[model samples]
Target: MDTRRLTQYVICVCVILTTVTLAQGQIKRCFACRSRGALGDCKDPFRFNSTHLVPGVKDEPCASGWCSKRIEGKKDGKDHDLAIERQCLQRSPPDDKERCSEALVGHRKIFICFCYGDLCNSASGIKPSFLLLFIPLAFQMLSSRF
Candidate 1:
């Protein structure tokens, strides 16, 4: 192979390898928050009550302690905030609802799956927020490459 061509090939290979390895593999935790401070994650996001997010949306947040998932995807956090806020109302104290509503939208998405009254967002691969994470990453990676 030509020397210059070989180097170019090598670089291309490196880039592909690196990018592919990180290509949206299911993390043991939420892709957004990665279970760092999250109480848990929602593995399956849609099983909840479609009418009520906390019940319909997977990995919704806890009452006062932690939000089911976090948001840091490509979508503007501001946008998802509206949806999260609407869902946040389902919780106990309806006071700080506005800001609490902002947790699930933006360049991120998290869903903590809990079984019986526990943090569910950071649970693991089963969380649906993981899907949103990849959806944007797919778009982002494509855009940057293009």
Candidate 2:
């Protein structure tokens, strides 16, 4: 192939590779569980017991690239029942920060945290990796050379 044609071919391959790499980061496997009354293993003080199987608790792929854990209950009472839910987010939250926020849904108050990365919604809170941020910049620099 000619020099120009070869350069174009190399650029095409690089673009394709970058796209694939970026897409891979968006796919995450997160713990999925929901418990209303019994508290089970889904509540705070989450026990990640792999040896003993727990019903309604498992890891599943999150297509939205975000996972969330939500706890719902009354703010004033210790005796009030609390609900815990961990699942893949249907859509990305407004803020990308990996932190917890308190919100009221009707009469019930909830504390929810959203994060990106595999199983990042665990008891440790959000675990976002900043490494993925450099991929696009690197690709841009590479393409500029051509």
Candidate 3:
């Protein structure tokens, strides 16, 4: 094959491989769990250790490429309870970002966070380490061709 054609073929292959790798990276696995009160593993101060052994919490893929955690505080006449949820999102929220935001639902207060990293909706919040780790690998692959 001619030099020009060989170079073009290599570039094309690299592009295709990169695209596939990036697409795979977009799908994230997040923790899915919910608890209506403070008695479950899904509640605040979530234990990150040995989560796989937990009965209610499991990892699920997020097709929308986003994971979210919602915490709702409900109050009755003189008692208060907390509802915690962590799951993979099917659709992106309007204010989808890597930060947590608060809102009022009736008399209850809710704090929801949307993130795009694997298991990012954990108790510690967003995890950008995945992207941070990918950038250098991608750059190395591209640079090695030169």
- What TM-score does each of the candidates earn? 0.20, 0.60, 0.60
Over 99-134, each residue of candidate 3 has an lDDT whose tens digit, in order, gives 778978788679888888777777774544454465
Clashing pairs in 3: none
Write one digit per residue (lDDT tens) for candidate 1, span 60-100: 34334323333332334333332221122224233423122
lDDT (tens digit, per residue) of candidate 2 on 23-56: 7666677789887665566776777733343877
Please give the CA lDDT of all the candidate structures.
Answer: 0.34, 0.73, 0.73
Residue 17 of model 1, lDDT score: 54
The CA lDDT at 19 in model 1 is: 71
Q: Per-residue lDDT for 93 in model 3? A: 77
Q: After superposing candidate 1, which stretches have Cα over 4 Å from the reference? A: 25-146
Superposed model 2: Cα runs more than 4 Å off: 1-26, 37-39, 49-53, 75-80, 125-146
What's the C-alpha lDDT at position 55 in model 1? 32
Runs of candidate 3 with Cα error greater than 4 angstroms are 1-24, 49-51, 74-80, 125-146
C-alpha-based local distance difference test score of model 3: 0.73
